[model samples]
Target: MQNGTVSMAELLNSSSALIFMGTGCSSAVPNAMCLIQPSDPPCSVCSQSLSIPPDLNPNYRGNTSLLIDHLQSNGEHSYILIDVGKTFREAALRWFTFHKIPRVDSVILTHEHADAVLGLDDIRAVQPFSPTNDISPTPIYLTEDSMNSVGVKFPYLVQKKLKEGQEVRRVSQLDWRIIESHHEKPFVASGLQFFPLPVMHGEDYVSLGFLFGETSKVAYISDISRFIPSTLSVISKSGGGQLDLLIIDTLYKTGSHNTHFCFPQTLDAVKTICPKRALLVGMTHEFDHHKDNEFLTEWSKREGIPVQLARDGLRVPIDL
Candidate 1:
């Protein structure tokens, strides 16, 4: 753990990359509703998903999540995961294996929604099941409210105890670390400094986005309906006033959502942040990756900023 602030030189030299573990909404792409209904043309995006391999199919998305792959100066490969949503098992099986990623070094959660936190138990796959195992418990970073909800949803994980007269069952051994999202405090996980960018998910609920990286700034806002002024200020104050990459939530091609950004809202936020490059995530079946990307390509040409939809399994290396 970096107990103090790290220098820009140290951060620049340490190799790291971002992985889009999943880029779909709660139901993921190829929505069950669309699949069940019989239509003349059918759901174009959902239909194409059936014919291609997942690695090659952008239409085949999983729940929104990100993985930070960092190669420390000491030669340790750190895998810091963000938000283990309901589709986390499928994401881990497919993306982790395909990318050859090892065990998760830590987990940073966005919020307590079922789509974001329901897969907490599945993380046990990477940890030692038996108490005698030598591996240390995985550290989990989340806000207090998120932890409270998590406790209600998975009492076994928080308490880590067997009930009276109940058989022993293995659960994920996690060290809960609460980050004060309201305070917008910065925390270091696996050697990277992450600034919590709190945004409104709904009128009464706030979700966290993250602004991290040193030489090449990257911001992630995977579940936000609207950006609060504080988040915009943080983004504007980032290195040299330029964000290298931004992966944000875009729930639909059009129309405003109550808890997720639609196409217009996403674009408004993007323009406000003015990132050098942007990738939209958390999309429903309304978007066709190829078609939507073509549209974004033209928009990028006109705006002079790159914008595209993020897909599951995409890895973006941070370069100098």
Candidate 2:
């Protein structure tokens, strides 16, 4: 294999999942306004990390996104991306470019929030290097509600037409497919099947989390305030009552939010699911890598489960 290229064989042989970006909420880590000055009083998480500078801190994360790679029967690689958010372009340039990821075979959206779908235009960057040459555009699997919102937000991309006298620029060529939120019947993308697990965003909204792989399942729920009972049951059945890895939303360390999970809720969900390992995502500036790690280490031992924080560029083998 080349130095930067990720071969299908490498991905298929792995036993872990790669977390391209990890953070709760849309703001991400190292918030500009939250940065503390020398004269300012210490600000717990952000204050202690100033010594290394925000740019240099490896813990600084982007919006939540996960990359799942699989090898097709024809010896081709399939890269599936979940949730292309506002920070996707920067994240891609920072990491995906260095790794030489050719193209995204499919995109499965969780919801239509700006932070989750604003980067649809950035898909144009991958068109030139796409391995597939079929007439169909890149496939994007999403729910009906999300599809409508995406069309409203990015009419040019969805409708494949430019406004009158509009300056011509490359836009994403996508084939939107409506997905059913049924865990029993999964949708296949690039040889890998995904089971949509529905969860509650808040009192007024809903979101979908995906369960991937067969024998050793990996569940990814980037933004959720609560899990539906049926969804939890599906997750449990995916791994015979214990998932291989559960990547969940942990938006804040404390305080309550109507639409995102706090540390207590996140921990409770993790415990209920009882995954072999858990990696928390969707974090904010309140979470300090150094401090959080220490706390999670102790918590993991106490609970008898391995849990850790997910950071950008962190790769784990998806051992199926």
Candidate 3:
């Protein structure tokens, strides 16, 4: 059995959780214009980082998405993707292509936001590599409301009938499965059971976090503004009252966001869950990789909790 910590290569080779992308808000790091010329008064993070070569600094990031890999007994692998945002293509090219992750077994969406579902069309790129000769569609799990939103966003893919005499265009291959976000029912996907932890996105929106695994439960909440007491109760009752790993949203260091969690809110949620280890996700350009790591190291020492900022290619093995 594996002990201590594992590397990204080892984690991807076995059953593990991989953070494919870690930026929370829409635009990715190292903004194009910022690279062209420094901000007026000089934005500390972007301006200074851009002055250095990308190969040297490497601070660019993509949208938040997680990949849960399950290694079958027969030596085959199944990959369940969580959230396919607009940056999915870029992230795939940067990470998945080199890793040889050709086909996705399933997908679980948190909500209907553009940053969470815009990459739905990009799944077509993997169709040619499907194992089955018939090219079976990948199943997607999401709430009914989210499903409706997806349908409206991609009508050509959702609707069976197209305009009369219009040729069928090659599109994303997918099967939509509506899942209830009641926090009581658990659903199976990619040969693993996932328990949904419903949380509030803001005053109006509702988003979902997930709890998975038997011996070592890993809770993933990529986007959330707040968590209700009932959700906290469910999480507290999981993994023997504490999470093994908690992946949460940290959109920014300061300021109050209406639909995303900032650093303070993320810390509050982490305090409630009290996970053994936590990784902050959904970050923006405000978070510099090297600088943030130093800050998190000090914070972790003070709080006595192992917490760090997640990067685009971070892979952590979940002990089961």
Candidate 4:
């Protein structure tokens, strides 16, 4: 078994990470309850490291709702939400309703696909305090190619306009952070180190995986069709067994899928990455929680690894 010892940092630097392992594909979100909740006040399982946000408008229907929450707490607690899928409005409302997320300081885009970035406008929920308070725009990070895609999708955000006495827009006007990179470039934004994992999505130059934070790290790879050799090297090099959690897309079951990781393929990745914990996300109606729980429980016991089947409202903490 891997070492069970935990590391302690001096002065207790404000560093913490959270993984919201749930399905984000297009399926109705399934309600889930704590499997490990206790029968008492201030319940432990009820108040796990992760909490599901409340439903605001209550009109969220598309794909499965598997949101990812990667947070860091050293000096000030910072949070990053990767891959705001088509259901971003719902996802944002759910997140804000459930947790005390201070503010979405910044956002990092994985790709320009609708499923990955359709939620770009959801940041309106966290603007500065006002009745009609014009809140500052939050910084969003993305590569040049992805930025082009964003400009195409959301033309209003990137289109330049000639305003008298305004050659450049003020920081508060636009919620953007242009990241100069393509797939596989080591890009840093908002005190977060992001390594874009080069992936194949059926010859389409879309989709990206990310490794976030500094000392302790979390890796997120969703909407990935194939994990190429070079990207594997980057992940292996940057991983350093310092990975507390790794989240990946496991869309299909055991069948062969051309553009995504099947069950066996995801298993192989787990064997390769060997994270302290591995969570399979992007589930669908085909993959039932009740059945997956049984399968994963047996699989974990046999494989001697901690493997979890992510649900719509489950939270996994990564703090050392």
Per TM-score, the best of the predicted structures is 1
lDDT of 4 by residue, 125-168 (tens): 55565443245666777767888888888775665464676444
What would you estimate as the lDDT of candidate 4?
A: 0.59
TM-score between model 1 and native: 0.91
Segments in model 4 whose C-alpha atoms lie over 4 Å from true places? 1-15, 19-22, 27-74, 129-134, 162-173, 180-184, 237-242
TM-score, one value per model? 0.91, 0.86, 0.88, 0.73
Candidate 1 lDDT, 239-278, residue by residue in tens:
2387989889999888888988999988887887789999
lDDT, candidate 3, equals 0.78
lDDT of each: 0.85, 0.78, 0.78, 0.59
Query: In every candidate, how many clashes are there?
Result: 0, 11, 1, 19
Please estimate how well model 1 matches the true structure, expressed as its whole-model Cα lDDT.
0.85
Sequence-dependent TM-score of model 4: 0.73
RMSD of each: 5.9, 4.2, 3.9, 9.2
Candidate 3 Cα outliers beyond 4 Å, as residue runs: 1-12, 47-58, 73-75, 129-134, 237-240
Off by over 4 Å in 2: 1-17, 36-39, 42-56, 73-75, 129-136, 161-168, 237-240
